[model samples]
Structures are given as structure tokens and as C-alpha cells.
Target: MENKTRTLYMIPYIGWIILFVVAPIALVVYYSFFDIHGNFTVGNYGKFFTPVYLKMAISSFWYAFLITIISLAAAYPTAYLLTKTKHKQLWLLLIIVPSWVNLLLKAYAFIGIFGAHGAANQFLDIIGIGTKQLLFTDFSFVFVSVYIFIPFMILPIFNALDNLNPSLLDATKDLGASKWTTFRRVILPLTLNGVKSGIQVVFIPSLSLFMLTRLIAGNRVITLGTAIEQHFLVTQDWGMGSTIAVFLIIAMFLIMALTGFRRRGA
Candidate 1:
């Protein structure tokens, strides 16, 4: 009866996944085989392999790598500090509140801050560094992405640290291990799963950031997500867009495979 009840409970969730996730992927795969005129063709896939699309893919990966690395660097230290705080939960909440704001709203807020006569430039002027163009630059895009993703990167690491056994640290101290040695040999390796989870969340989404690339980057950084949006919305090339989506899906699967945790006792 418990087994029956478990299966019954899973029915709705399984149905929802098939209806939403599986159906959309199936549609995209189907559309990828057809041309703009609805005629069946494989030219879309061929075009994706060409230099133009290849370069865009490389650029997108590079940006995602930078965003992930920067977010990890900032987040790890913040998470460690939070773990040491008396009111760590409250501090963590404060850190995450910015992420709860809508992405578009945050993007617009950055635009104002980074604009020509904005706070950033004004501060520069006051500091003897004259105002310079800050908006719509690579720096702005990377900064904003890191700001948005840092919370995600922090949460998992925080959980890992919070759950860590304090006795391990005591043992390391008793063994005459220095702080750096303890961290390098023990702390980091144990928390590696959390780091992996953080990278999975940050890097995958960064690869497909269309709105920020448009607003903060001023269309200068053309990531795969932007290309997909342009093909579908502007050019009305559904086939090509679907082809890109298929490849993006493949890339996502590859990332998941690379980052996925090992099964216990496997």
C-alpha cells in the first residue's frame, strides 16, 4: 500500500515533467529539422558548425567562465565570513535579498548606476579619477552577473560549512597543521561538493544570459542566448533557433554530467 501511495504521489509530478519539459524539448528537436519555409532540411545544423556560430559559442563559454570564477571567488569568502557570524542566518538573508528582486529591475538599476553621469562616474570624479564611460561595457556586464550569481554560489557553500564537523578542525589544530594547510588539505576538499553545486548553478545560467547582454552589454557581447533570441524573434528563423536550442540542451546535459555527484556505494 505504501508503494502504491508513492507511485500515486509521483504521477502528478511525472506528468508535469512530461507535459512541460519533455514536450518542449521534443518540439524544439522537431522544429530543428525544418527550414524557415517549413521544408525539411539539415542545413541549420551545418550552419551552427560554421565559424560564426563557433566563435559565438567560444565567446559565450569565456564569459560564463569569467562570471563563474569571479562569483566563486567573492562568494566563498563571503560564505566563510557568514559562517563565522553570530547572526549568520540574518546576514545570509541580507545577502540573498538582492537576488529576490526581478532580473530586469536589477539590470535597469545597474544601468542607472553605471550611466555617464551616474554614481560610479561621480565617485570617480570626486576621487581625482575623471568620469569615464562605465555603462554598456564588458566590466559592467561581468560585475552585474557576479552580483546576481554570488548569492547562489554562497548558499551551498554556507550549508556545507554549517554542516561540517567542528571536531575535524580541532583534529587539524592538534596535528600542528597551519590554517593554510588545513584549508588546502581538508576544508576545501570536503566542501568541494558545495563548490561544484555552486559552479553548476552559476555557469549554466551565465552561458544563456540574454537580457543582461542586451542591456548592460549594449549588444556588444553576443552570447548564444542572444543569438537564439535574435533568430527566433527578429529573423523569424524558427528552424535555426530550434537548432541552437537543441545544441544548448546538449551543452546543458554535458555540464550536468560533468558536475553531477557520484552515487553512494557505486
Candidate 2:
């Protein structure tokens, strides 16, 4: 009876996944292999391997990789300190509060901060420094991406660090391990799952970030996400758009696989 009840409770969740997740993916797959006229073709998939499309895909991966690395680097230390802080909850609340703002609004806010006469350049001018171009550059795009995604990375690492058994650290110290040695051998491995989770959360979204690329980078950065949007909305080429979406999904899965995210006992 208990098993039956549990299964019954899961029915709605399973149905929801099938209806929303599975159905959309299935549609994408279908459209990827068909043209607008419903004729079967491999041309859409073939376009992805062409030099221009391939370059865009690589650029997208590179941008996402940079964002993930920077976010992790910043988040790991902050999360570690958060674990040791007296007012951890307060600090965490502050860290996540910015994420509550609308993403477009946040991007727009950075526009003013990074504009030529914006706060950053104005402050520099006040200090006898000449104004420099800050907006519509790769740096601005990456900075905004890292700022937006850092919270995602930090929360997972904080959770992992907070849940660590303190006795294990004491044991490592008792064994004459140096602080660096303890972290290298024990703390890092233990918190790796959190790191992996954070990477997935940040890296995946960073790959197909269209809005920020347009608003912050001023379309100077062309990524796979931008390609998809152009194909679907501007060109009205649903087949090509679906093909790019499929490729993006595959790339994400490959990243997860390479990270050992699916390894047994991970």
C-alpha cells in the first residue's frame, strides 16, 4: 500500500516532465531533421558543422568556459569563508539578493555602470584618469555573466562546505596534515560534487545567453545562442534553430559526461 501511494504521488511529476520536458525536446528533434515544407533533410544538421557555424559554437563554448572558471574561482573562496563566518545566513542572503532582480534589468543596470560617461569612467575621470570605453566589449559581457552566475556557483559550494563533518577536519589535523595538505587531499575531494553542480548550473546557461550578449556586448559577441535567435526570429528558419538547439543540448551532455558527473558513486 505504501509503495502504491508513493507511485501515485509521483504520477503527476512524471506526467509534467513528459509533457513539458520530453515533449519539447521531441519536437526539437523532429524539426531539426525537417524543413519548413515538412520534407526530410540533413541540411540543417550539416550547417552546424560548417566553418562559420562551427566557429560560433566554439566561441560560445569558450565564453561559457571562461564564465564558469571565473565564477568557480570567486565562489569557492567566498563559500569557504562563508562556512567559517559568524553571520553566514546574512552574508548568503546578501549574496543571493541580487539574483532576485530581473535578468534584463540587471543587464540594463550594468549598461549605465559600463557606459562611456557611466559611473566607472566618471570615477576614473575624477581621479585624473581619462575615460575609457567600457561597454560593448568582451570584458563587459563576461563581467556581467560572471556577476549574474556567481550566486548559482556559490550556493552549491556553500551547501557542500556547510554539510562537511567537522570531525573529519580534526582527524586530518591530528594526522599532522598541514592546512594546505588537508584542503588539497580532503576538503577539495569532498566538495567536488558541489563544484560539479555549480559548473552545470552556470556553464549551461552561459552557453546560450542571448539577451546579455545583445544588451551588454552590443552584438559584438556572436554565440550559438545568438545564432539560434537569429534563425528562429529574424530568419524564420525553425529547422536551423531546432538544429542549433539540438547541438547545444548535446554539447551540454558531453560537458557533463566529461566532468564525470555521471560516474557511479559520484
State TM-scores per candidate. 0.96, 0.96
In angstroms, how far off is 234's CA in candidate 2? 1.6
Model 1, TM vs. native: 0.96
Candidate 1 per-residue lDDT over residues 1-266, each given as its tens digit:
99999999999999999999999999999999999899999999999999999999999999999999999999899899999999999999999999889999999999999999899999999999999988888999999999999999999999988888989999999999999999998888888889889999999999999999989999989999999999899999999999988988898889888887564231
Clashes of each: 0, 0
lDDT of each: 0.93, 0.93
Runs in model 1 with CA error above 4 Å? 263-266
Highest-TM-score candidate: 1
Query: What RMSD value applies to candidate 1?
Result: 1.5
